[model samples]
Target: MSEYQKPLPIIEFQAQKEFWDGCKKHQLLIQKCRDCGEINRRSVRMLCPNCLSGNLEFIQASGKGKIYSFSTIMAYPPQGFQDDVPYVVAIIDLEEGTRFRSNIVDCDIDALKCDMDVEVVWEDITDEYALPKFRPLKQGS
Candidate 1:
């Protein structure tokens, strides 16, 4: 097996389709409710979590955030992740006032901390898809 095997996402549903489409283009898209403007950052649902509005629009995110909380996985990772055992999984608080759960890459896990600034880094795993990962923002950036 290859040392670096990336797992592909299941994009059989419409929501998955839209999300993956944006990722393929290196764009970060999030759903915002048309009625209440509540940004649904993590879960993909048909209606708004706030007002139960079925009108949700996908908008491009700024791709900037801070690590609210995180965990460093050094062992016992799931399938397709065993190759990347020492990785950071963070709940990022986006500048747009939403939170997203993503992997934190391109940095030492020991340097991670709560409220540390981070920026999105796209990992081109497949010809038709890319995963949106985050990394620590450089000083003075």
Candidate 2:
């Protein structure tokens, strides 16, 4: 393994495991409230934000979104991303009205723009783990 791979995020609990398991399967999963049909992307609260009910389940997301905002990383890389110093980190607003932060890959950093259409691309970090990334959608795709 590479040095950067040694310090990966720990999936310790059931909630975390469930989320990461979907990643391993190359799927973008989001928590949905059964009570209110609300989708929770960033928040991990057990209760539904709309109905205050404790019935939530992870479901496959559409894997489509637009870039809300972004930053280019040119230095001082994080432990697992040392090899990828020059990269784009972005907040993507999904079509489902939820947003999540992830790396923007497979495109020129200089070409990135806010509101650019993007789609999910999985980075298989290991046999049991994957990272959900985004890439600019092609014009005709």
Candidate 3:
């Protein structure tokens, strides 16, 4: 069996379609304000938070980033994610200057650092959804 393990949460929302779609193909995506050119994570609105312009775009992410901040989850997730307890949940600072909230999997969780170099990975949680996680990119994958 693969070293991966997860019991995922139920994601129900119409706005997150594009983000979910990219994950199916192992691609990370983020929102860009078509008006001011600012990047963000959640697909919340058409208006740019910075300039308040109703123009936005979803762009494919580079899948490379650094650990901006993180916390080791000691408690169980609301419904799913019991087996994966004690895992590291982190906010990654992308090279593009936006932050992504995802888990750092596939290695010792305690080994992570505040500015560690990490790469994106797509974990297929179901037929219709994939979760973007991170793995320590070793010398070779």
Best candidate according to lDDT:
1
Q: Candidate 2 on 1-141: residue-level lDDT in tens?
A: 243354566765677788888888888888898888888755566677778888989888899999999999999986767877898989999988899998899998898999999999988777778889999999999
> Which runs in model 3 stand beyond 4 Å of their true positions?
1-15, 41-43, 75-77
Root-mean-square deviation (CA) per prediction:
2.4, 2.0, 3.9
The 10-residue segment with the lowest total lDDT in model 3: 1-10
Clashing pairs in 3: none
lDDT of each: 0.87, 0.85, 0.76
How well does candidate 1 score on lDDT at residue 39?
87
Worst 10 residues of 2 by lDDT: 1-10
TM-score of each: 0.87, 0.88, 0.79
- Candidate 1 TM-score versus the reference: 0.87
lDDT for 114 (candidate 2): 99
Clash pairs, model 1 backbone:
none
